[model samples]
Target: MRAIVVERTGGPEVLAPADRADPVPGPGEVVIDVAAAGVNFIDIYHRSGHYKMPLPFTPGIEAAGTVTAVGPDVTGLSAGDLVASSDVRGAYAERAVIDADRAVPVPAALSAEDAAAAMLQGMTAHYLTHSTYAVQPGDTVLVHAAAGGMGLLLTQYVKLLGGRVIGTVSTPDKERLAREAGADEIVGYAGCAAAVRELTGGEGVPVVYDGVGKATFEDSLAALRRRGTLALYGAASGPVPPFDPARLAPSGSLFLTRPTLVHHIATREELTTRATDVLTRIARGELRLHIGRRYRLADARTAHEDLAGRRTTGKLLLLP
Candidate 1:
């Protein structure tokens, strides 16, 4: 077996692929022969020491593949079932262990690659639109990084719920992609604040999804109508600096929250429900996943370099 081990908190190069003993199923866990691993910005944070983890570990959180074995206490899943899972150990390898509670059966219609692509980004987008803000019909919302993985999914899902999406992107190519994903107005983020005002008739949207964080926080705060909500989920441009809560009142009396998927879908039932809804849409062709980059397990460094430099869009995957 081979695993991309994170020997230290440093650069992507620190993820060194080496032969290692294959992970075996423990009680309440299953061993998956991984076909794909989902690469996320959080992987970068772990590499950079922004998110602390025990050193000498594998650097992936999500994977999809065929189940080879299941441990005692595991039920509903059997060997040879195609599945996708998050909250797993050492997913960036030939084989990984998945907690039975966190594993979800992938739709039979979906390919292994597609299942892997949708698990993390799709779940995040689903929870953001349907759980965190719970956007309703006629709600005008803004999505930053709208060309990226979660951004595309969120835009489409929000529109499917009859809400309007104002998407911000760094380039014309991404702007085109965002529009294809149901973004009603695609704004070039160079003059984002002004563009947002124009798009909203100077009133701004009702909710701003700010994953770009420090780079777009102030403008995202500005691009909202009174009593609007700002869902700051990720900090791709770096974390938001400290601020005063009282400032929310002066800034259109806004509501702000930092939401994560773990908090929103804590229980096994909640996780399975959300995963089923999102995966059903994808399987039925109502929603689509764009896997913009693919890297072999050994090329994890190059993958991170491209992602950190914003050289890729949509979901990035590591084929094991």
Candidate 2:
């Protein structure tokens, strides 16, 4: 099977297309004939050594496909079960062996590409809105990178909760997208978080969702009111600078949490429940997935380059 292998961490160019031996399922694993793979910020972090991983691995984390075989101890699934998974290895390939516990059945109304697009990012948006802080109606929230993959869906989710969404984007075009996603106000964050103070009448917001990391961490916390929450989900700009927790107290007695979907949806049941909520919304045409970029499986490097460069708007995928 062909897979994009990362032997050394550096940049997108480090990803080399290779034909490796086909993966065989281990106990509790299932081998999927991958039809689509989702590209994620974490994949880039893994590839660049920003997030440490053992050397020599495939980069993608999420994919959707058909099960070709199930491993020992796997049950309630069979060959030809249409499914999607997150937090798995070797997804950027023609076929991948993922833990059976991580795979969720796909809805008939959702296509492979759409399901792949929704799996990781959609669930992240779900858990972020549902668990991280449990956003409430009439609450004022600020979402950075509000035109990006999870941002668009999150904007909608926040709006659905009746929260006021103040989205920060880098460009005028993205501002329009944020508005369409139901953001109450869109601010330009070309490189700063001062807009938060401006957009919220100097009172700051109740929650600050910062995925831009290094560039926006401190300001994101500062943009919140006393006792508000600061949820940092990604680090596209770079890893956040070290800070004193005492600063959080003085800033506003703020709550800070760094969350990941894997931590939120730890088991098959949890994974299935969260995935169903997002997929059902998509199936109902309530949640929107903008598949902003598509690349052939062999073009994985290009996909990484665009994502790392912040040239992408929404979900990016690789199809074989």
Best by TM-score: 1
- Over 1-320, each residue of candidate 1 has an lDDT whose tens digit, in order, gives 98999888898779898999978789999999999999998889988899999988888988999999999999899999999976768888999999998999998889989989998888888888887788899988999999999899999999989999989988999988999999998887777777878877888888888888999998888888889889999999999999999999988889999988887669988899889998899999999999999999999999999998999889999999
Report how far off residue 2 is in candidate 1 (Å).
Answer: 0.6
lDDT (CA) per prediction:
0.89, 0.88
Top-lDDT candidate index: 1
Clashes of 2: 0
Off by over 4 Å in 1: none
Candidate 2 TM-score, C-alpha based: 0.96
Span of ten consecutive residues with least summed lDDT in model 2: 187-196
Q: Tell me the TM-score of each prediction against the true structure.
A: 0.98, 0.96
